[model samples]
Target chain A: MPITRRRLLTAGGGLALAGATAAACGSNTGRGGGGSGGSLSHWYHQYGEPGTEQAVRRYAAAYKKTRISVQWRPGGNFDQQTAAALLSGSGPDVFEVNGPTLDQILGGQVVDLTDLLKDVKDDFQQAVLAPKTHDGRIWGIPQTVDTQLLYYRKSLLDKAGVRPPRTLDELVDAARRLTDRRTKGLFLGNDGGAGVLGATPLHAAGLSPVTADGKVGFDDPAAARTLAKIRKLYEDKALLLGAPADWSDPSAFVQGLTAMQWSGLWALPQITKALGDDVGVLPFPADGPAGKPAVPVGAYAAAVSARSDRKAEAKAYVRWLWVEQTGYQEDFALSYGLHLPARTSLARKADRLRQGPAAEASRFAAEHGHADPLLWTVASKVAYQDALSRIIKDGADPEGQLKAVVRTTEAELARVRKRS
Target chain B: MPPAALRPLTSNTTRRQRNRTLWFWVFVGPFAVGLALFTYVPLGWSVFLSFFDAHNTVTPTDFTGFGNYRRILSDPEFRSSLTTFAVFTAIIVPATFALSLALALAVNRLRWAQAFFRSVFFLPTACSYVVAALVWKMSIFNGVRFGLANTVLGWFGAEPVAWLATTQPPWYWLVIGTVRLWLQTGFYMILFLAGLQRIPVRLYEAAALDGARPGWQTFRHITFPALRATSVAVALLLVINAFQAFDEFFNLLSDARGYPPYARPPLVYLYYTALGQGQDLGLGSAGAVVLALVIAVVTVVQARWSGLGRKEE
Candidate 1:
């Protein structure tokens, strides 16, 4: 009790010890109970569609078994945040990934969810399941399939006397002819088609992202030529450059800023609401002798974390929300945004998708759709995308860029192979 | 026996020193612990992780010594990011220094509404970088005819240009540079204003009496030289800040698709490599360590050149 120096030192040390003990006892991340007990943390990237957050939260609220806390991570950094959180052992117990990456699959960041789909595996679309599987184990449950293709205004094309392009050259010419004092021909993003169309040209040229044996599949010379055609569109300034929104939203097309825009099936409802029957859908047109018209199909899949302490509960939550709940799945795909139901049966039963541009889009997706290879990592994708940007925006030699990308892709493939 | 009186004084002095020491520990101890825990611990852990094969996990048993460093060094993308950083620094540092100094000089010379001008100029400093980048991307520099820049160009019968696109002219540099300048120059201007006010009025009067010209000559002889210390400090800070630039570039160019390869700073690139889908923390940590070294060397070299902490003669 005396104000002695020794007493002060002792008191300080004791306080420090007590503080450390309290801090250690506290939760690392403020959102606790993901590891144990009655609560679970579910994360989804901020979907651009209105009511997406409300809808996901509504679904979470319906689950009576466990208290599900949904963290709607905003912006494009969801993958980064998920990866970091997983590494730190503080990530969501159940989460949504665009698809399971090689890192997530190989490193055991995601648990094998094939057990959830065992009985109903045949009902789900194979294209949606392919990217989520590794070594015959499904790492994720397909929630919604987003098909990226071209959306054009029928009225604008009719006014300009431009038919829906069936070939890459025709698409370019149509884009050129549609440009005038006000409206530009097409919009493929602010980067002049780099973000969305980067891989499209490869698919348009009939090149696979990766070979069946896991080799770099986009190294052919024809791949470069297809990209060069995109550059021609850029050079002509026919492609609508920067709009308020990027190519993801159908804003450019709906606002009549561009006659045609590259967007996903998710934007179909908004586009239909804005333009009605005047809107038309087309696959990115075929290029070269071996080419076929193509649509890039991607899916947002629900994956449970392997490192989650409550793995069984998380899996049950995933299974309950994505598997047993067909109504919620259909609503997630159709009501909030227009995406194809991951279940083939649900897609078949959906009356809305059976008519109009949706039907055309679904047909194109089945006929000409190309899903990215499971072996192709995000690093390879970034490299390939950068090559496309350089080719289209900067007039860099496509052959050279593609060659460089091949090296990067091969290295990534080798790394994955080594790990596996 | 003769020094007995002085012994009590000595004892009192010792007690006062002890009390001061105890108070110092009380004030500084908590902050020192926090600094160690938050900053130094992570820094040390990062260095340790740089030598491991930490792909998706932080704790790793596989020690791949120098492999991550080799990969980062050999990576063309990382090298390209370094080049981008260098170009950004070269553009931003001089432009910011000159503009901020000019603003300070202008505001200092104003006899009326100086406070108003200062506040007006300083307001952008309060705006978040992400918000400003969004405004710049969505409204001002957007390539559409309705965008502010394009609309202005339209009045002159000019075609709308994609200001952020990697076109032949590379107008994105202008957009990035201008936003940073607008955001940062005000803060530095305030620093220069403080430096300006600190100068003795007698020196300027003496310079005027010595037949120095009022505008350029007096500025060169008196004003510029007097503000050397502030100038050095500001330039050093600007250089470091430029190297660490992230939020604006990340917000403006990056999206769900990807970042354009051209303007990616090291930190953004590292964020993607270490934390993005690749989740290769080892390689990312190596890049970070290398970046930190580069920043440290640059800062030291700049301080040496500018004589930043040297005593004025």
Candidate 2:
């Protein structure tokens, strides 16, 4: 009890160290029970407006038989939090996974959902499910399908006397008509670099840089044609080059500075909030010999942690959420408007989404979406984009650039295969 | 009589020696434990991992002796990353030293608000690197029409420059250097300030009495000797930081794949290879070991040249 300097210093230092460690490794589980009361903790990136919390609560209450608690982490940076939690063994029992960060998370023990999905495997769309499988095992259920669509200013399109294009040439004509010195036709101003350039075009061409077997098999004349079109657009001054990258906001398009923009279904709520009546959505124009329009599909998946102490409980929750819960689609629709339902049946039900341009866009993307098969390998897609972007931006020879990328990608694929 | 005298002396010497030994252990024990736990232990683990095909997950690991190192030497991406890191360090180290020294001199001359100026200069160091990078990415150096840099350029009738997007020479170097300078100048400024404060006033006074100008006086008497230790410290810190420049590149320039296009330093590349892209921990470990040796050799050479190991007068 004596206040000696030595004792005080020792106690203070010990307390400080303990506090630091706790802060580093602590879980923000005040809202959810961690396995107690038969509760399973779930974490997801925040979606939609203020009404989203209500929808989440509604879903949780309706599915009370499962005794699962959904705790929403409010931010777009869920990957960082999830990574830290995973490293510390305190990650959510059920969490979301993006395409690029999937391999990193899987390096840790992620649950194999083969048994869980066996009962309801046929209910989900194949396009949605394809990206979530690895080595013949289903790792997650696709929660939402995100496919790129062309957002255009309805008034501008009407004034320019143009309809949404079905082919690359038609798109260029439409773009030229809409473009002026003051206002450009399209904005592909990517801040990160050429990866953004390759995704849409590659998806449209149906040429993924990596195969399911982890081989580079994406060198095609279709890819070359897509690159050539992008370059021509850039050279003709029909495209704006300095807009903010990730310009998913429809306000810019609605404002008429940019006549057209490329974005996914995730931008629907914001677009509706900003420009409610003056927007239209169409699939990305195709350039292949088949002339079938294609849109790039992005998706989020829900996977249970392999390290979860209660795998049965987690699996039960997943089954209830994906299959048995009738209100799941409605919850998603109300929370994040324009989100494409992963289930084919729900997407076919037109009443699920809001009655506006967003609903039409969601329908278009869902029906015509094509995801790049390189979704499993992170490096090859990046390398491909880097190569593609250089060719477009620097006017490098398309064939030579594509060949170089193919070579690098094949080598990288070989390395991955050898190690695995 | 001689035996009796020798007995007391021996007893006294033995007690003193025991006391000194106890003090030495008391002073050194915590550091020894810390070094073992934080530094030596991880280092040993990395070295051991270098000899094996380690995975990030808790799977059964296989021993592939020197395979990772051999692969790293042959890997083109690894080679590119090493070259990038070396270039970054070479440019940043000298620039930071010169700027910090200049700032320190300017602050030393100011008779008012020295603390205020120092704090103002060091404020950037207080921010999280991610926050700083994001701010730089969105507001200051944004590529859009309304971005600060672009707006400024527009006023001069010059076209907007895509500072972050371009892969060309001066633009890429400028962006990297600006970010590096923003974070590092403050650290080196503090170091230089401390060194400047330690110089004796008598030397400056003597120079002034001899009709030496302030600039020449500083150069000949105070600045040269004062900066010896500070230069060594800054060089070593810069080398370590350059090798570990992950947060800036990772946050600002990174693609969705977690590899930056133009600015992938060796550490960022290692991270992308290990956990982000390939998930090849074996090659990543090899890259890491190579980076560590590079830093170690650089620091040792810097210390030797700067006389950092010499005893002070």
Whole-model lDDT values for every prediction: 0.88, 0.69
Query: Model 1 misses residue A264 by how many Å?
Result: 1.1
- lDDT string for model 1 (B94-162, tens) is 999999999999999999999999999999999999999999998999988999999999999999998
- Please identify model 1 stretches exceeding 4 Å from their true place: A1-36, B1-15
TM-score of the B chain in each candidate versus the native B chain: 0.94, 0.85
Candidate 2 per-residue lDDT over residues B216-253, each given as its tens digit: 66576667766777777787777777777778777677
TM-score of each: 0.94, 0.85
Tens digit of lDDT per residue, candidate 2, span A1-420? 679985686677668767977995674653244555666777777764556667766776676655666778875456655654554456678887664244543464577887877877877878768777766788877876766677777888898899877777877788888887457777654542254444666656665556556666567777777877777776565666545445544545655568887765667667766776777877777777744666667677888776577878888887787666646754674456556777767766647464676666665666666666634355566566666666766667888878877877776566555654
**Candidate 1: fraction of native contacts reproduced:** 0.87
Residue range A17-86, candidate 1, lDDT tens digits? 7898798788445247444555788999999889999999999999988888888889667877777788
Q: Which candidate wins on TM-score?
A: 1
Most DockQ-accurate candidate: 1
The true-versus-predicted C-alpha distance at residue A239 of model 1, in Å, is: 1.0
Residue B241, candidate 2: alpha-carbon lDDT: 75
Best by lDDT: 1
Model 2 docking category: acceptable
